[model samples]
Target: MALKINKTAVKEAKAGDKPQELRFEDGLILRVQPSGVRTYYVEVARGKRVRIGRVGTVTPAMAAEAAKRLSVKVMGEGVEAVMPVRAITLEKFIADVYEPFVEHEHRRGKRTAEDLRRSFADLLSTKLDRITSRELDAWVRGRREDGVKAATIAREANQLQGALRFAVERKHLKVSPFDTWKAPNVPQGNVERYLTTQEKAAIRKALSDRDRQQARERASANKWRRERRYPELPMVADHVMPMVLVLLNTGMRYGEVVKLEWQAVNLTTRTITVVGEKAKAGRGRIIQLNDEALKVLTTWRALTNRTTGLVFQCDGEPIKSIKTAWKTIKKMSGVENVRIHDLRHDFASSIVQRGGSVYVVQKLLGHGNVSQTMRYAHLADEQAAKAVALLDGHKRGGR
Candidate 1:
C-alpha cells in the first residue's frame, strides 16, 4: 500500500495559516511543504511525528513524486531516486549515487562494467543536462590517445548517453548533450579472435599440466592452500591455469567464472547455476557446461569438501578479483593484449565460427538484451566468407 498525496492541496497547506497535510500509504504526511523550499518531506514514527530532510524545494507536483519515491523505497521496491537532480558531474554524480545503484550489475556485467566504470569515472564533469555534442565529441576525442581504438571508445561513450537519457526522462537534466552530437567514425581494428582447434589443444595441454602437477604435489596441496593473512599464493598452478580453461569453455564473466560453487554446478548435467547478489542482475542464471569445462570441474571436485556449493574457491576462501594473478598468468602464456574477458568473446566467437546462430549465441551469453551478443556477429560474417571462398575455389578459377 502507498500513500497518495494531493500535491495541489499540499502546496496550499504551505501557503495558508492552516497547514494542508497529505498522508502517504506508510502513515506519513506530505506534511506542510512551502513553495521554493524543499521539494518533499515526510512525517516519521513515534508519538510526535518528525519531519525528514527535504528532497528539493522545487514545486508541489515535483515534491509529491519525491515523497512517493521515499515511500516506495521504504516498502522495499527499487525506487528510482533523484539523488542530485540539479548537481551534475561525472565524478560527483557517480560518487553520490550511481555506484550504489549499479553495484549489483558489477557482478554480472564483468569486463563490460569494469571498462565502462573506468571511462565514466574519468569524465568528472560535463553536466548531464547541458552536455553539448561538442563536449561529448571532445570527451572521446581526448580519450583517443596512444592508438586507442574508436569502437572501444564509442562503446564507453554510449554509457554516458544512456545516463543522460535516463536523467532527461527523470527531468533531472533538461537536454541530452548527445542530441546535437555527431558520432565520430569508429575504426574496426581486429576481427574477433577465437581459439582455433589447435589453440584449444594448447590450452588443454596447459590444463593437463596443472592436473599432473597436482598429482605429484599432493603433500603440497595443503601447503599451497595454507596462508598467513593472504600470503604469497602458489599463484600459477591450482587456480590460474585452470581458470583460463574454464573461461574458454563457458561464456562466463570473470566474476561468474571464479565464483562458481560446486553446489551450484551439477556434474551429472554439466551446468552451473548462478545466484543473486553474486550476479549482475539480482537474479539467478544457469550456464550449460561443455565437455572441457565439465572435465576441469570433475578434476576439481575430488580435491574439495562439499561443505559449500562453490566450485572454484581456493582453500576455504572464495576467489575474488583475479586481476593480479591473471596478469602473471598472461605473461606466462605469452598472449599479448588478450584479456580474461576476451575469453568470453572467444566463446561467443567460437560459437559463430562453428556455425552457431546469433540467437543461439545470445542465449549462451545470458545477456539481458541481445545487443551485447551482437558484438560477436563479425565472427558469423567470417563464417559466411569462408563458405563463399569454398564455392569460388570449387570453380576453375576464383569467381
Candidate 2:
C-alpha cells in the first residue's frame, strides 16, 4: 500500500508473512521485511532503486532530501557533471583501471607493471586526490633513508609520475599530484668503470687456471672410473672466459649476450644483430665483430655440440644467472672493483683511446643518444691534442 512514511508510521508498521513496502512521495520508500526490519530506499521514476539507510539510522526528512537529489540526477539535470571529480583510492584505480590499461592498451610487459606496483606499494591505500607534493617528498626521503641511490630513486619517481599522469588522462583523477613534484637530484654524468690491460690479463689467467684444474680433475676421475675403483666425475663446463671476452669486445649488455641466439650471429658478415626484444633500447642494433670477438665466438661454437639456440647456455638451456661465478672470478683475478658492465665501458674506452670518434663509439655501443657516449670524451683528449698539433706552425711547413 502507498502511504507517506513518517517516524510514527514507520514504528507502527508491522512485519507481514512476506515483505511489505510503503511508498512515499519523491521516490522515497520504507520497506518492511518479514523480520520487521525497516529500510529506506529512493526509487527513481525509471524504477531504479538506490538504498538510502536503515529506518532508525535515516529519518523520513533525510530520505526525502536524498530522493529529491536523486530525482534531479535521474532527470539529467547534472548527472554527468560529478563523475570526473569523484575521488578513488590509489590502490583501487591502479588495480581496476591503471594496470589493465598498461598491460593491454599500452603493450607494456608484465614485469614493468609489477615493478610499478612495487614502487608505489606504500602509497597504494592513499586517495588519488589526496596525494600531494609533500607526500611525494616524504616518499623520496624514505627511499633515501633506505639507502637507495639517487639515480634509482629518480627512475622510480619518474615511473610513478607517469602512472599519475595516466590517471589524470583517464579522468580517474582531476590532476596529477606529482605534476609539480621534483625527483631527487641524480649525478649529471655517468660513472664509467673499465678494466685496465693488466687487470684484463689477470682475469684471463684466472679463467685459464680454473679450466686447467677442472680438466685435471676430469682426467683423474676418468682414470679411476676406468679402473673400476671410483665413480666417474662430472666434467665442468667453462663459460666465463668466452663470455667475458665477448662483453669486453662487443660492448653488449650482459642480458643481451646471455639471450643471444645462434641465428642472430653471422660469421660470414662478422656481425651480431641484437634483436629489438632483447636490446635495452627496444631497437635492434648491429655489432661489428673484431678479431678477438670473432675468435671467442668461433672457439665457443666449436666447443658446443648444439647446432642451434643460445650462444651461451648451461645444460643446453640459456644461462639463468652467473652472479656467483662472476663474483668468485673477480675475487680470484684481483679485479675487485670492476663489474660485468664495466666490460662494455672498457670496450668504449678502448675505441675512443684509439682515436675513434664519439659518433663511432655511440654507434658501436648502440646508444640511443650521443650524450650516453660522451662519458668517453676524456679518452679522446689525446686525439684532440694531436689535431691541434697539426695546426702548429712549427709542425706545418709554411702552411
CA lDDT, every prediction?
A: 0.62, 0.78
lDDT of 1 by residue, 1-399 (tens): 764555555545444454555566544455453453433444333443334445344455555555555656645732233233474765655555555555646663344445555565435655555557766666565454212457667777787776666567755676677777778885444535455666566555655665566556764654665643344434333666567778878877676766666678788987888776566565567888888788877776664545365666656666644555555544544555555666777888887888999888877777778887888788789889989888767685744
Residue-pair clashes per candidate: 19, 0
- The CA lDDT at 53 in model 2 is 88
Q: What is the per-residue lDDT of model 2 for residues 1-399, given as tens digits with 9 covering 90 to 100? A: 446656788787799999998888777888899998989887764555778989778888888888878877777854433333667888887778777877886656455566666666678788888889888887775554333458778888877788889888887788787767666564323447767889989988887886787688889879989799777766756787788789888999887898899999888899999988788658678999999899989888888754579989877776755566777788788887566777788889999988889999888888899998998998799778887887796656775
Best by TM-score: 2
Clash pairs for candidate 2: none
TM-score of candidate 2 versus the correct structure, residues matched by position? 0.54
Error of 1 at 181 (Å): 28
